[model samples]
Target chain A: MLKAIKGIPLYLLALFLFIVTGLPFLIMFLTSFKGQMEFMTSPWSFPESFSLDNYKLLAELQFFGYFANSLVVSVVSVIIVILIAAMASYPLARLKFRLNRPIFILFMVGMMIPIHTTLVPIFILTNKMGLYDSLFGLIGPYIAFALPISIVIFTQFMRDIPKELEESAKMDGCSHLRLFWSIIFPLLTPAVATVAIYNFIHIWNEFIFALVLTNSTQNATLPIGLREFYGEFSVNIPGIMAALTLGSLPLLLVYFIAQEKIVTGLAAGSVKG
Target chain B: MSRLQEISLDTVHVRKKKKNKDTWVIIGFIAPAFIIYGVYVIYSIFMTFYYSTFDWTGIDANMVFVGLDNYIQLFQDDVFWTSIQNNFLLVIASLLTQLPVGLIMALLLFSPIKGMRLFRSVYFMPFLMSTVAIGILFIFIYEGNYGLLNAILEGIGLESLQTAWIGKESTAIWAVIATVCWQFAPFYMILFRATMVGIPEELYEAADIDGASGWQRFKSITLPLLKPIIITSAILSVIGSLKYFDLIYVMTGGGPNNSTELMATYMYKQTFTNFNMGYGSSISFSMFIIAFIVTVFILLGDRSTRGNG
Candidate 1:
């Protein structure tokens, strides 16, 4: 009886936190299906009837196009960042070279830089290169910014693997490229997953660069599109909420599926630092 | 020659060739990341510094340089100062709220509890959602008319307390900070929990044997061991709040007279919205410097704490 009584406080506290954290999302989700009258009259109440009109309206507004744009940019950037950062990190971790330390430090600099610091120059440079308003323009900066931490995470992960595997592969007449592909790259799967999720989430949710680099509807990522959607549909609360839900649905799905990886990836960055 | 000597001679030659090849291979591997990061991020930082010396509006490259003029103007700018102040306020608020609340959540969830995974995920939902979505959700909750918050306040018979949360000058920054705190507290909770799990069970068992109260055990064992992560989270929070932009940008746009203006949003407005590229670049560089200095300062504090320990 005493133990049961003691457990009550913890349960209550947990329940309080769960509601405090989850209420906004719950409200957003529920209200997305709510009609104008339902939302206006009973803001805190559940909808009397579930409605698909808001989602339909959002679909008509080319919400899927923005979703696709975000996917392409985020996926492509994640791929490029993981590949190049992993490749660079391998040498920094395992090899002895004159510039290795300096190069690693250079990548670390990216972690410290406020993205705004580089925005104007990168904007001008991308525009000059004729990459402005293109997905590729966003990719370049995304890959660049994602590199430092990806490299750090990958390098730290790589340094821990036993050197014997690589040396044996070398002694077997396996070329460096062959060894990396066959031996090292395979061992780096965990690190790759961490870097992949980290970059994907960041790039997927990123707004500033997407906002600055792309101007056309075809090029706009989810965040930018959702912003415009909100602006246009401000009066249509349900419609705006539908658009916001669509924008967030993909990432939330990824998070749920890879909860451990997502949590560890995020914690890894800070803990390692 | 013996077989061993013959193989050794051949191996030496091959090793030298491989060494030479390895150098090129390393260079090849590092080049892609280096070139892209160099040209875009690193070089852009330098460009920001260079542009800070000029008076160009970013429309054309051909403009006269007025060295330090933008920096001087930035120093005198009240909005700029206000933005810096807000950033510090955010840093303080994050340190005070996110850390403690997160630590409490971590401690409560640390033990074997019912539906721990569910609770964990629920707590972290805010952190997982896109900032834009979170911002939009908060905007609705903070909406003056037919908003959730006002509704709740009214439901609890606090109708007089309901006001424009994000529209009023007095409550605007605090409202945004509350939203930010809500969004990020889970991050520290997860982080601290991860660290707390690594803590061995024997210490807790021994403390329990000693009849140490839960708070006593937490204060003596958990807080002391959690110090490193605590420092790290503090630094992360401070640096993050310093560079924070997205949610605040979406929700407030640093509005109601720029009450919630942050260094990042100010830089964005100056460069993109106002076309004061030079002055904007100056602000950006200053942000970079401030982020760097604050990170190093926190790290130094961590070092001092470690020394004492």
Candidate 2:
């Protein structure tokens, strides 16, 4: 009887987390197909007809424009981050440089200060450079902000790459650039993949700087697009929901497809950090 | 013999020259990332400090330094205190709710269960979605009229319990905290489960051989092992909860009169809206001091725990 009672509660709790953790996403999915009257009347209920009406309406708009902008920014930034972080992390991990530890601690301190504190000043600087209202303004700071964590991830991963590779390359009298490019870069793909995935999601979802940096409708990214759609009020609910769904679907898909890598990436921090 | 010896020595010298160039190669590789990140982080921190003491708005050139005035004003400002209080409430709620809840989920999934791995991915669905979308989704959930929350309550025939959760001063902050905990708990749960997976299977088998029940095995094995991770996660939780912004901003807009305003949101408003640039920076500096102190405590605590373990 005691065992039976415990079993019941265990199942009940699982059911509860499953629901509470899940229902909001379910609602977002459900509401995208919901029409005005149906949404007002019954939000939790399934849509009366599976309608693409909302999706169809949103497609006619500049939907692809924001999608392109997000892709460009996130991809470009992720590429730059991986390249620069690979280069930076190699020495920090492998070399016995005098400044290496101090440089590493510097990154730790960088992680402490919230970027929001620096937003106003960066915005002012970006404005003065005439990079304001342009995509170029967003890229520079985005790379700057992403580098600390990327450097940390890469350097940690690089340490595990055996020292034999460097020694063997040296025995052959290979140049350092050639050694790294030919020997180390390919071996660090797992770390690069993990950091790239992490950075891509962050840049894709980021809103504040995108809002401040881009003034025109043409330049705004997906999150900013969502905020602007909010300003259109009640008439645009279905359209906005479609846009939100569109914005989030790619990430949801990637997370599912790369669940193992993502789980490994997360677990490393759990055990090690 | 002399000519042959000279030629061999020249080849050796060329090889050494190539290796020397390679030593600085690592430096060259890391330089760009370091330079860019270094300038931005170091420069912006002090620049904000300098601006905090001035009277000029973001656009203006006029700079007037009033020493310590902004810091003094931050203490007496009622809204600033309220924001700080709300942040405290979040720290408390997250510790109480998110941490334990994540542990429970982690433990449940940690045990052998059918389809638990599948459940893990599905459970993390909300964590992957944009905070902006989560924000909007909650606004719908908390809507006073024809909302999911009220509909569910009424369906269950608990009509009296229905109220404007995010719309009111009392419930608004708690409402935001609850959503945040729900969304993020899965992230921490995944982290904990990873640690759990690494524990040796032999320990559990040994417990069974000793006639230990499931409860006894979990208590003796799992709980004892999870301590380090729990400590690290707690520090992360504390630090993360302090900078809380995106979700709260989207839901309440810190409104029904400043109830859910976190430090980040409040800083944005003071600096950008009222143009109290100095005051805003002062509050930011204060928050930094608090975070640094907490971080020091975390590091010290981590060292002691790791040492004993």
Candidate 2 chain A: 10-residue stretch with minimal lDDT: A1-10
**lDDT per residue (tens digit) for residues B213-279 in model 1:** 8778878888888888988788778888899999889999989888889999999998899998988
Residue A171 miss distance in model 2 (angstroms): 1.0
**Model 2 residue B47 CA deviation in Å:** 0.8
Q: Name the lDDT of candidate 2.
A: 0.79
Model 1 iRMSD vs. native: 2.9
At residue A49, candidate 1 shows an lDDT of: 82
Tens digits of per-residue lDDT, candidate 2, A1-273, equal: 012125657767777788887777777777789888887666578878879988887677677788889889999999998899788888888887568899888875766677766777787888889999888888888888888778888888888888997898889988677888899999988787778877887898887788668999899888887776666645556566777788789998888888888877766733453
**A183-269 in candidate 1: lDDT tens per residue?**
989998888888887778788889999999999999999999989998988788888888878787877887889888889878876
| Model 2 ranges off by over 4 Å | A1-6, A269-273, B1-23
TM-score of chain B as predicted in candidate 1: 0.91
lDDT, residue B169, model 2: 84
Q: What DockQ, between 0 and 1, does each candidate earn?
A: 0.59, 0.51
